[model samples]
Target: MTPVNPESSTLYVQSLATGVQVLRAFNTQRASMSLPEIASAVGISKSAAQRFAFTLEALGMLKKDSQSKRYSLSSANLESGYQYLQCHPLLERANPYLLDLNQRTGETVNLAEPADDCMVYIGRFSSLARLIAHVPIGQRIPMFCASTGRAYLSSLSDDAAREILERSDRVRYTPQTVTDVDALLTLVQQAREEGFACCHDQFYRGDLALAVPIWDAAGNAVAGLNLSVSSTSFTVKRAINKFVPLMLETARLISTTPPNPTALRPFRTEPRGPKEAG
Candidate 1:
């Protein structure tokens, strides 16, 4: 006959839950986390957090800090994500198309997906001029402040889209940033009708971006494709008229293409180093 201790059982459960929460905090933002930082953010006891973190470290899922004695995520998570991408034939096919668009347009082109209340640029090609990328790959940008985000939101149900808007603080990145929830909702509806979204100095300070949703065979846009140009390069009307159509065509080509057979990868699945993490 065996009996379990109630207090011990509760302790084990809290430890497990706290460990997962600790891991969640290591996204694109603030990738590397110190023990104290993690404990504060997870709102867990220091001893409990340390035990959980050491467990993850033993599992080869967290790298320890020597000087600061903190911790960061390891590379093991990338294998799981890479395996999932291997199954998604669409993302592979879409790559060559993205590359071609970059070559032809002479501007940066990006593909993004909804993440929390924002959109993360999953794939992108850079232009001749270097840009200040405040939101890098695996990072998030607000739905109201990014044309790519708005394009993705515009394709979703109104109730669902409105919920995202309501949750976001709509921090004013620039004077052009749309912080009004009602007005942002209206803009999303208009994007749906126009089949694209355009915004100037919204997501980026000097960048003007035109984004459109890429519809799959099932008629759902699982992601948004965006063409971005600096204000110095062109005006809004010219970008819409000259580049929008090409962008749509390139999206379809990439969307319909076959999965990559090679293993070369660029996306980040684990916590990034301090230098790259914003």
Candidate 2:
């Protein structure tokens, strides 16, 4: 969990934070939950959960099932997300390039930005061809296992990367996931050497991803650009040989100018669940 800076603690509103947490309790895995479940998930009392749920429902951010009393995120929640995408300067600049790459590769293209120890998918362009799965915007993948995560880490100092790796839970999601901090650091080093990162079936079965970090004019790593392909469609060598150049070129084009430092931010109030991390 990311806490506000101690210096700004006086400015933080606990109620507002808790309200956002209540909304975040719903996800692809847990699409709908009961009041008791919400209370348990948010670490609040049942009455508190009920009040928040009631308020959210009234505000149209959440909807309650009349029969089951289960609450789920409403369409109104998309307003904030849509507004963010529309207003983000970096996203605005990257969309054309991302679309070009999507058309060129006919594969999944994503732009992910770091949020604490995770990388959140802020931009996603789906493949025209057959897809194994669909990952929506706002998806958070652990920095320890995701190719995008590793790519972003490669751009950071070794000590900075190690600190985040240590803070991670490091749960092995698949046979290919490198949970050991030393092993993971080695992968980051390899990315630094190769100028990109690759992962094969680390977070999802039959999913292979290659990523490169996006940098600003000042040389700060601001985001990661990645393309995901099905294992059935291409081997690691084929993917690297074919897509790496395209990925690098696209990233370079998008990084021509720096964007607002605060343009990209995470929307979640908590860390993503195991299945959600890739």
Candidate 3:
């Protein structure tokens, strides 16, 4: 769980924040945990962890094993995410475009938005071909290594992109992951000039991806649209030559359409640390 601000606004509910923290403790890696483990992971007392666990269970967001007493997230927990996706007009508007791109390229396509120092996948369309990486919706990848992240950064000024990179953890996920800030800045600059970003096996060993930034009517880069293929099938240059034009066209279409005001809320950045690359 992320630490809370000590000098937060008076309206802030610390208890509710803590409860949410407890819920976030469950992830793909640690799917289930005992009270003591949760307490340790969340930096809370065992009693506090117990209360939060029980409350979440009662709220139908979590489930506990009767025999082992280990807690795991319940299917009901996905309802919140489902509701967000259902109401998000950006995803609704971009779905057909992403689907078309996926069908045409026969590769995984994704829509992501910047959140602090990373890009979070909000929508995805998988290819008919075998997937090189299985990145689910809501998965976060560092800005320094992901094509979507670099594409989003390309929409910003160099100074602004540098600030984000400075705050990032900058962990080298693979041999191709560029941890050097200067090298990453060069990549972002190239993307800025080229109108798109392309990465080969940076985050995933066998994945090649290209991305273009999606802008709002006001010209702010509100999101990134990406197309990813297996490295074994196509070289990075070939993928870019094939799909970058299509991605740019889709981005232009989304930009011209007025976005639903309420749908923009979830894309807003919140304070959080970077996640280890998948």
Q: Please name the candidate that would achieve the greatest lDDT relative to the true structure.
A: 2
Q: What TM-score should be assigned to candidate 1?
A: 0.78
The residue pairs that clash in candidate 1, if any, are: 93-257, 94-254
The per-model lDDT (C-alpha) reads 0.73, 0.84, 0.81
* Residue lDDT tens for model 2, 91-192: 989999999999999999999999999999999899978676677798889988888999899887889999999999888888767788887888787678
Q: How close is candidate 2 to the true structure, as a TM-score?
A: 0.85
lDDT tens digits, residue span 1-278, model 1: 22366535534576566677888878767688887888888888788778888899998888997887878888986777668556756667777888898899888888887778878777778887656454455667877788888888877888988999998988888766778888788878767766677777776778888887776666676778888887776766667777877876776665543212110122222322322111
Can you write out model 3's per-residue Cα lDDT over 106-201, one digit (the tens) per residue? Answer: 878999998999999999999876888789999999988999999888878899999999989998888868788888898887677667777777
The count of backbone overlaps in candidate 1 is: 2
Whole-model lDDT, model 2:
0.84
What TM-score do all the candidates reach, one by one? Answer: 0.78, 0.85, 0.88
Error of 3 at 87 (Å): 0.7
